[model samples]
Every structure is written in structure tokens, then in C-alpha cells.
Target: MRKLDNNEDGNFNKKISNSPANKRINLRENPYVARIRDETESMRAYINYETAKEQVRRIDDAKDLCDEIKKMSEDLNSNFYSNLEISNSFGDIHLEDIPDGLRGSVKYIADNTGWSYLSVLLFVLLSIAAATRGRYIAKINDEWLEAITLYVIVCAESGNMKSNLLKLVMRPHESFENRKQAQHAEKLSKSNNVDIVIAREIALKQSQKNHGKDLVICKEALKTLANNVRHDRNMINDYCPVEEASALPRVFTEDTSFPKLYATMQDNGGGSTFASAEGNTFLHLVLASRSPLDIFTKAHGYEKFITETKRDGTKILQQPFLNIGIVVNPDIARQLYSNDRLGLHGLSPRFAVCFGGKQDEIVEDNSSKSDYNSYSEKIENLLEDNFTQEPSRKLIEIQFSPEAKEQLLIILKETEKEQNRTPKGQTHYRAYLRKIRGLVARIATILHIWGHAKPDNHFVSKNDVLIAKKIVYSISLHAEYAFSANGLSAYYDAQKILDWIKRHRHSFFTSTQVAKGIEKMKNDNIFPALDALEKLNIIRQLITPSKPRLCVVHKNFITSA
Candidate 1:
């Protein structure tokens, strides 16, 4: 995310086209550094010159380690799935497995733009589920263990056609809802018995306690009634938000204030999706909030969440039905990753993150708006087909086949073992494996429903589970990419110092000279950063009887930078 000036581009890490496969090749021609660049091209990612060099070196080191693991796993078990050959790209999704009508459009858009097919395809799928989250929870034990709600994020540059692609994907869903909300509102407006009076806010338990009656029974009855009433409402994503003193309907909000979003969800049915391309807006909201998003974290586990707001003296026993999708930059990605480390509930980790970069300039040939409509309409049509019974419809329980469970168990065991062998600081993101199993199950159920993969019994089959594995593996790679990108931000200052050292050609510089180079370097971190640079072999330290202790920049760093 660092801005590169023209002068800086001379040795700016031999940049590559930012695709998921991320084909390692320099953007501009450079005959002098071509040999080293070509040698490192296949392994390095687009990062600071030194960091990318370090990454290439580390990758070279890991090849031997991977070889060791391969040998060990082969000796222990031949069916080990995580290997170099299989770890090709983020993941490969068979277009045939995708629900009909989605593959063509998603692929078309991705192909036309500099976006990955998997990234675009997954975005469309998650958005579909997001549009239809409420009234349709995928169940595993007939008890709705799988939330069916999803949170996915893809980080890319602004010019990467993120907004355009989203607009095309979202068009049909929004259009369908706009029409449905109109019809529902019109019908309600015409109704004579519709409740126009606002309900008074008084705790029934307090009243029952005052009356010397059983408060528990009263609260229980209230809870049931509240749930029933909320369910009975026409809960669909409303484009126009309701005004103050009016009931706020369900909405697919983008970059909204949490408090307003929270209130809107409560008014509608305590479920909503926040899908946004402008990720910084949400970051700004979180930073400006009175407290961090506890609801978001609690929602992941569907924990016993309660919110009592002082503004309206309102209390809500919030449900864990919220979904989110956002496109973010590296700065916000770093911030979210850091915040995830700070909290016990861990809002940031709950999100399934994917990263994207600029791809080759796509063919100028474009798809028409109507073509976009055709794909989004397929999603809308599927949503209607799933929830045909409009008013009082409920989620259908889709059980997993017995064999599916066995397959899932095997995947879980292998994934956990693989994670155990992961290098330190990288495996922290694997903690979400506790939830990912259920998430994969939910996605399988969703795919079954969407694809209409007709089976003898109303249960998810092994085929569905297999598809889920591919999806989950892809998601894991994305999580690794995103979290790793954020980790690089911690060394931002160090990378800057490296750049300075390489540029200034300092063979032997004192602390005072370092001060002259960087007038405002952190007093405490300068020495540690220098030590780190030395450890990375980007620089070396020397001490002599005739001279003060001085640091010398590595000779190759100048070329590499």
C-alpha cells in the first residue's frame, strides 16, 4: 500500500501483476537485474524491495522444510492432501459445481477485469447467501448449528473494478428487493388492522415482580412473543431506511454506523448484512465508536449477547445473524488484524478474508449491462425459489449424510495436523478452525440448495462435502494471504529505514548520522530496527579501537532496492 514515486520505482522490488496465481514477473523491463529477478520471480510477492527479497529467501528455505514434511507425511500417511503439487493457487473451483447461471456471468466479469475468477465467484456466492440469510438457516442437527451467515472480504486497489463488479453482482438482488419492499409496504399501507401505535418500552419482568407474580414465566412469554412478532414481519433487505419514529425494515447496508445498523436490525428482525466496497468507512466508524464492536465478535459464536443503549434506554437480546463483506486496503487490513489480537471475542478473525491485486489489463471487450443483469437475476430467481412461502416461511433443515460426516472428520484432522506444522506467527489465524468446520458445512448446505443437487434423501451428500473442501481450502489460502499482508505492516518503519540505508550508500554510519538521515525515527525502535536489519543481513555492525561502533549497509541491497 506504500505510494511509490517515479524515483523510487527504479528498484521497487521488480513488481509483478497482482493476481491470485500472482505470476512472478516484473512489470517494466530491466536487463541489469533480470537474472536475480527471474530467479526470485516465482516466489516473491509484491512488497517492499527488502521484504520481497526476504520473502524469496524465506521461501527458498521453506522449500527444504516442505520437502522434509512431504517425506514425513508420506512415511506416516500417503493420503496427505497438503503438498506442494496440490497447493497450486488459492484454489480452483470447477465451474460445473457452481449453481447454474452464476458461472458464466461471474467468469465473464472476472475475465473482463483484472480480477481472479475465484475471487469474483466467491464474492457472488457469499452475496447471494447474504441477500437471503434470514428465514433460511442451514441446519446440521435439525437445531440450526450452522448459522448460514457468512462474512467475506476481498482487498484490492480502488481501480481494480471492485465497485463495478459488485454493482453488477448486486443489481438483481437490489432490484428484486426494491420491488418486493414496495409491494409489502403498499399492502401494509392499505391494511386497516396494521399496528400504527408504537409499543411502549417497559420491562414486563419489572411489572410482574411489582405485581408479586412469577417474573420468569412473564419474561419467557415475552421472549416467545417477541421472536414470533419479529419473524412475522416481512424481513427483506430494504434499500431506503425507515425514518425516526417509524419501523426500520431489514437492510443490506454498506458502510453504516453500527448503532444505526444495530437499531435497524432490531426493528426488522435482528439480522442484516453489511456489504461494502469502501472498507475505510467501516474502519472510520469503528474508530469513532464509543466502544469496539462487541456484537460483531459475539455474533460469531451466537453467544448470549445483550445490548442496552443509553440513547433510547432500549435493550435488545441480539441474535448472531449478521453477515459482512467488504473490500479493504492494507492499512485497514493491518488495523483489523491488530484489533483481532486485542479482543477475546475476536471480531476480525471471524471474517473470512481474501486478498486481490492488479491483474493484467483485461481485454477491452466488455459485457453489456443487460448481460450483468442476467447473472444477478439468476441469484434473485434462486432466492425466490428457495423461500417461495413468503410471510411465515422458516428455514428448512438439511441434514448431512453419514458419510459426509466421516469425510469432514478426516478433513478436520488433516487440516489441524497441517496447521500444527505451520511456522509461528502464521498459525494464529488457524484458531478459527473451530468455527470453520461448521462454516464449511453451512456452505455445503447452501450449495446443495442453490445447485438443486437432487438427492434421494433431504441430506447433504459427500459430493457437497467435497465441494466444500475446495471452497474451504481456497478460503484458507486467502486468510493466510490477508493475515500475512497485515503482518508485513508491522515492519513498515523497518522497511523504510532499509530503503534509506540502501539509497544513501552508508558503509559506516554512527547513530548521529542515522539521526541526520531520519530526523524523526522512534527513539526506542531505531536501535532494535537496526539490529533487525543486521539480523536480516541487509546491514552489518562493526566495532574498532580507532572508530565508534558503526553499521554498514549490505552491498547487494543497493541493487535489490
Candidate 2:
């Protein structure tokens, strides 16, 4: 009976293999199989690299160490992430530890956003976490209470639901504005406009003259006046009145000048979020006006930012609280970082970046509209509950427990090793590593608030520390991959070798066959080049543990042929 079953199974498989649908696999034309086959080639790439390294060592070359360095760089550029999958490199950890109130909503959006919901959640929570900026502090040790505020970047491609998620999660800020506007209209309806204009002029003059405590009185007077008389076309940096500026009435903005940002934070008591769904929306403006970067880099923490304007040498002092999130796709990322200004200016190190491949397809949800509505409502409720907290009440501080402190140090040391192991020419990698430990601390604070709605706890728990480390590790890996995307053009040279395999019309080929087919490529470069092409999923090798490996062309081998 077993023999008969085996024979039947083998004949059934043989019939399927000879079918028309399966014929494309033989021609290497089916993309789905091509993707699965790429994973196998990835392994061959690592083996080839090791084999080449061994051979390179055994050779007594006339070339010096500099020549070897150049060759090594070329090899790394061609097969950057082939050896390790960035997705699973960090291993797994528990991601279901979201606050019970927000869990269903988080999962609902995660189902449809076409983004890693975890990534989306991190961005969303950090935006909301801005409220806890100076209100709650952390004690790493016995010395001081550390203010925890993390700034994150969602580096995803366009049309990946970044904007939709931002719109959905950021509803409370808009709601708050609408509520406030109604209140303002009721109070200031019959106020005189001439009095307001006179008040603003007096306030500006007094601010310039005294730079003193009386400026507060002047600021408030101007704010009341400005609110009564609305100006649609307000000047840059002059958009908000000095008094009402920092305490932002409108919390979320896609476009804002540095002065406007400063005013928002100031009015909001030094705590607010600035988020850009598309990276290019603000980056182009930022790059053109370079001075804002200096202020933003320091304002993420409690440190005071003193910016001196070139226009009139006006000095602006701010000890503001700011949390910024930028969603950058590959095209914008390359353009932003390639100029080297952000790195050179020492600002790139401040952000905790979430970058990698974004989802290309949307996940379909067949759930009823009520289910979706309930999810959005829960998220809004979470934000509303937090936002409506007593603005004038005493609040307790948050800290890391002794064990959590030790755990944090261990994670810092792990990051330190990564910093040291980073190779030369990738100096920005070392620069960005400086902020990882700090970011971990801030993320721990976020989790603490997220897991427990109220800040009743004194110390961060062991679970929070564990989750924070996982977030850091993932971001660091993606950062390395994102910054190194520039060197990938070297992989294009592998196309010549792939074309040669196609021209021969052989089902399988050996190194000799490749050599015979390629009339132009030099003998010395052939093997190393073939190794790179294989790594890039341009070709594959049929595995035979006891026999010589045979070359199998990738399904898209003749793409440029």
C-alpha cells in the first residue's frame, strides 16, 4: 500500500511539472518562483565571498594593502544585505504589549495600512508622547531626573498609507483646535481691532528694549489683540504672537517655518509635535534654510537652543520641548543624506530612524465598517483622554528601576560594539550610533506611558526595557542599510556575466562555460564578478553536495539583454 501511494504521488508531481503553467519555471520566467529562488542564491553568495577571501589571502600579490582595500569595498558594495536578511536579523520579541485601550485600534489600522503596524505605532505613540516632555522625568541613577523625549523618522516610500495613518491617529489635535477656535470666537467677538494692532507694536518694541520679565505682559497683551484680528497672510516667524506662539493652538502641520515652530512650542509650554508625512514636504525647505537644523537638534531634549539670525543679528533663546517625526522614502532619503549636510552639521545623529522596505500592497480587511469605526474611535478616545488631562495639576515623575538601569547599560554597551565595528568611509554610521542609547531611554519612557495610561509608576519595568532594546536594534540595522544604499550601483556590472549565461542557451553551466561565453571580461575578474551577480539574484547555482556546482540563470536574467 505504501509503495502504491509513493508511485501515485511521484506520477502526480511529474504530471504537474510537465504542465504549461510549470513550463515557465523551466524558462525562469515566473516572478513568484524567481523571488523564492533568490533566497537560495543569497546563501551561495556568502559561500562564494568566503571562498574568494580565502583565495585572496593565499595569493602572494604584488599589490599593496590599498589595492586590497579597494577590492574589499567593491565586494561589500555589490552584496550589501545578501548575507543577512534585515527583516529577521534582530530575532523576535513580544510586540503585543500595547496599552489595552489602544490595542484593537492599533491592530485594525495595522491590518489595512500597508506598513509595519509596529513601525506606525512607534511613530504615533512618540507623537502623542510629546505631551509628557517635561511633565514626567526619569531617574537613570540617584543624581538627576532625565527628561525623556524621542524623535522618530518613518522612512517609507510614498503611497504606503503614511498620510492616511497620520490623518487617522492625529485626529485629536485637529479636534482640539476646533474646540479652542469655538471658545476663542465666543470670547473675542466684540473686541476692538485697532486696540489689538496698537498692542502688538507696543509689545514688539518693549521686547526689543527690555528683554525682561515685562515682556510676558507685553506678549499676553499682543496675543489677545492678534487673536481678535485674524491675518490670513502672516509673515514667516511672525505668524504667531510672541505670547501665544509656544502654546500651539494647532498641533499638527505639514508646512511650518522655524519661527512658527518655535512659537507653537512656546505657547504649548515647550511640548508639541511636528510631523511630515512625506519627507520631501519639509526637507526641501529645511535644506534651503539651514539654520533651523541647529535649533531642532538640541530642542529634542531640555537643552536651550540659542539661534542668531543672519538677517538682523536678532538673538532668539528657547529651552523648548519638541518631538519631530519624518517619513522618508528611498528617493527622499538619498537626496536628503547624499548632500552630507545633515551629517556634517551633526544633526542626523539625533533622530531614531525607522527605515527599510515598506509594504508595496495593501492588506485587505473584510471586517464590517463598524469594526473599523470602533478602531478609529478607540484611538481618538485614547488621544482625547490623554489630551484632556489637567493642564494645571501636580504630576508625578517616571524613572528606571535599579534592574532596568542595569539592563539599559547592557544595551548601551551592545550599541558601543556596533559603533566600534563600523568600518571606515561609513563615518556617519558612527555618528548616528551616539544617539542610540539616548533614544532607547526615551523609547522606554514612551512604553511606560503607553503600557500604563497614567504616570502613577515611579520606575520603568523590565518589560519596557526589553521592548525598548528591540526597537533600537531594529532601527540601527535599518539605518545601516539606508545610509549604505548609495554604493549599490556597483551591482550593475554583474549584468554582463548574466547576459553571457543566457547567450550560451545552456540549461546549466560551469565556470568554464561562463568564461567561454564572455568574450570581453578579463579572466581574473570573471569569478569575483560571477560571485557578485549570484549574490544579487541575477543567477543561481544548482546544488549537488558531491558534484561540481552548475550555474542556473535567474528568471529575469535577460532583462537588459
Candidate 3:
């Protein structure tokens, strides 16, 4: 009878292999077998359903079988199939025999549930254990082998699971056995760090092939696995691969020894090395450092120490580190260092050393005195030897109106009084005025080139001098001929005067025109004010046109004013 039953079983298996529904039913009897059968059937259905309609119902049946198979697989132990060579015999069934509909259903179930069963089971057991110690376990089979099977599944499917599994394990549970299993599972997940990494690599490859839609799913799986591992302290410290944990996406282990990592990063040449490993380059690792000082120090040290160039011609040292924070005080630096060495990881000794120095003293002491002396000598030589010819001076006539002339005299007297009131012993005061005059002369020449008259240069008002100084400083700061609208207007007026002289061949404005122009200018209050220009010898009155007479309309007058 036993031999007959065996023969019948063999025949039934053969018939099931040829029949889609029968095959799915047989697979649903064993969880592992059911999972594989569901996946295979679904994949086949998906491939064939595109061409056939009758296969859709079969696909739905296959999906039902897959779910049933997954539940059984989670519930069953290896002993349930100990007598059967399940792994070897399971592969012999022809998935093509399954109807397209059943195959599609199976594939969907497998794709979604195959990797997540263990995580779900663990989460349930953990939750139950938290509520009632023996009540949950006593109600179900507390088989060790069954639990281990679930553990293996958790590790294998870590890449596909959710981070919630981690939280579940970390939560307090009543059963010590359940807690131990959770802890073990968590550790295994972390230790299997390479699984998610491989998943990510596969995802990236898929993305490169224009399969970006699959990237999010793959990335989520990888993140889930990493989070599960990070939730348990024991798992984090023991089973988690320090290097691989560091490599995992979103795995932030602050306790990592960055200095040690940096030292490991250093090449034989004393420079930082960006050696390639497991899809990440040394440059990638260095760039991942969160400590600014660690980043800076590593970057600077890498540049100082590393010698190899990447395929793209970028040196390892060239990679920038992220999460940089400025060290304001050494006290802060010391505190950061004491609390966490990684916090101080990227700072350079030079930066920390110079943080306390006086800005002015540092600048003065660092400047080369010999270089300054050489520069001064070059300037004196240029002034004396090269500039031997006097600058051509055009005489400008100035016959200010009675009111304008009176205003000029009053301004001049005020300036002279201020000069006299300045401390007599202060040579710097005199030097400052001379500097101002020189700046005004140069500014006027520039204005003439741009076709404008010099604006008011009177220093009688401190505010006026400050405005002028700002203009000069602005030009110097930019190292270019930058001027405001007012400065441009002044330049245009000076150029007009130059143009007038060139066009007239030494003619000057008549006294009435001069008076009218001055009166109009006074009303506008454009700078350098007329009085200031005359005082600086930028424009003066000519005594004569032929003999250079001191007449308001004379060429000398025009040139000097």
C-alpha cells in the first residue's frame, strides 16, 4: 500500500507539473516552495498575458496560491520538508505549464511579499511578546528552527524591508527569547550590509539604463536594511561592518573614529589616497566626512600627501568634505575635541593656530619690508626720470559772477582757517591735505579723458572731503575706472572744457558767459565746486589771450580755472 501511495504521489506530481492550478496548489502547501512557485508563475503569467486573455484568471489564482504559500512558509519549519529534497525537486517543475493569469498573480505576490514575510513575522512576534510573555508563544509553535528560518529570511530580504522593522525590534518586549531573536535578526541585517549595497549597485545600473522608476524602490529597500541594523546598539557595534556601515546610504554613525579613518585614507606617499573599493572611491569616502575640520584637515593633508590622479584628472585631495563648521575660539575647539574627536576631524593646525592672532599686527609683520622699499624706489624713479616733461597745462578763464566770486572767497577763507587750526606739530595733517590735492589732480585728468569737468574739490567741509575720499577709494578698491553718475557728470564736463580749448585753438569764454556759467553751476552745486578747482591749479584765469593777460576770457584764465 505504501509503494502504491508513493507511485500515486509521483504521478500526482507529474500531473501537477503539467497543470497550472494543480502546480500552484502543491506549491502553496510549503511556504518556501510556495514563494518560489508564486514568483515563477507570476513572472510567466506577466510574460504570456500580453498575448493571451484566458490566462488572466489563472494569474489571479496563482497570486492567491502565492499568498497562501508565503503564509505557510512563514509558519512552517525546515523539518516540515526534511524528507523531501525540496530545493532540488522544486526547480524541476515547468513554470510554462501555469496559465498566464495565474503566473501574473504569482509574480506580483512574490515581488511584494517574498522578501517581507520574515520582517512581518518578526514584527508581530515582537509586538505580541511586548503585550503577553508566554501567551503569544504558547498559542503558537515556539520552534527554534522556525524562528531561525524567519531570521534567514529577514537577513536576505533586509534590502526590501522597511525601517519600521528596526523600531519594532528596539521596542521593549516581554519575552527574552523574542528580544534575543530580534537582536540577533537586527545584527544579521547590519552584518549583511553588502546585500543593500549590492541592491543599490543594481539600482544604479538599472537607472543608467533609463530605469529611474525602479531606483526609488531599490533605494528604499537599501535604506530599510541599514535602519534595521542601526536600531540595536549591540548590532551596530558588533555585526555592523565599520567600513560597510560607513558606506551604506543614510547610516550615520557619529561614534566612528574619524582620525583613524583619515589615517587609513592616507596613502604611502603621506598624501591622502582615494583607493577604489566596492563601488566607492577614496574621494567618495573623504567627501562623506561630516566634520568640517576633519574635512579640511583631510583635504589639505590629502593635497599635501597624495600623489595619484583619478581617471578624470581629479586628485583625491580635490574632493570637498561636507558639513563644515567654523571654529571661532580655541575654547570651543577644545570642547568639541574633548566631546568628540570626529567633531574636530577636519581642522588644520594652521587654521586653529592663527585664530587668536591680531589682524593688524599679523598684516604688518607678515608684509616684506624689503619689497615695500623696492616698490617705493621704483615709484620715485618713475616720477623723476620718466616724467621729466611738465604736463601740458591748459589755461581756464574764471570770471565768476559777483555773488559766485563772493561765495568762493568765503569758502577759501574757511578752508585756510581750518588748515591753520589743525595741530601745528601734526605733519600727518599737512601730508593728508597734499594727498587729497594729488588725488583731486589725478581725478580731474581722468574726468577730462572721459569728457567731463572736475566736480567740487573744496575741503572746507569735512563731509565734502569724505565724499571725495570715498570716490577715490571706490576706484582703488575695484582696481578699475568705476565712477558714480555724479563722477561721470564731472568727467564729462572736464572733457567738454578740453574739447572746447582744442576746437577754439586757445579761445576762452567771455566774462559774461563765465559769470552766467558760474552762477548756473552754483545753483546746481555740482562738484568739484568751482572754487576748489581754482585753488588746486586745475583751472585758472588767463591774464591775456595773446600775451596771456589776467582777463576773465583769456586762455590762461580758462586753463587755470
Give the whole-model CA lDDT for all candidates, comma-separated.
0.59, 0.58, 0.30
Clashes of 2: 10
lDDT at 531, model 1: 58
Model 2: CA > 4 A from native: 1-102, 142-146, 190-248, 310-317, 356-396, 485-536, 539-561
Better of 1 and 3 by TM-score: 1
How does model 1 score by TM-score? Answer: 0.60
Better of 1 and 3 by lDDT: 1
Model 3: per-residue lDDT, tens digit, 1-561? Answer: 355578788998788688978776776688898789889999998878765765777798779756654553343232222111000111111234322222332222223333222222222222221121111001011221000000000111113233333332322321332443465567667756776557555544543444333445677766864454444433334433333322111101122344433333321112111111011222233334353334444332122323332542423333211111121222232222223233223221112111111111112232334432332333233222211111121222111134333443444464466457755543323333323332322222222211212212221233323332333332221111111122222333333444444455543243334334443443123333222223333333433344311211223333443
Q: What is the lDDT of candidate 1?
A: 0.59
User: How many collisions per candidate?
Assistant: 0, 10, 56
Q: Predicted candidate 3: what Cα RMSD to the true structure?
A: 49.7
lDDT of 1 by residue, 467-500 (tens): 7777777777666644552232433445557657
- Which of the two candidates, 2 or 3, achieves a greater lDDT against the reference? 2
Ranking by TM-score, best first?
1, 2, 3
Rank by lDDT, highest first.
1, 2, 3
Q: Write the per-residue lDDT of candidate 2 for residues 1-561, one digit (tens) a residue.
A: 345588888999999999987886676876777887998899899999999987887564525434543443333333223221112222221346554445555566665665665676676566546545445556676674455666677665455667776665565556665776566564454343455656667656554444333434677766855543333214312633333311325455444576665545555455466776776656755677444676666666566666555763543434455667777665565555555777777666666766533443666764534544654454455445534212232335677887888887887798789878888677777888876776777777777775665655556887778777776776676677545532211122244555555575553466666666667645344555556555655455544465444555443334333
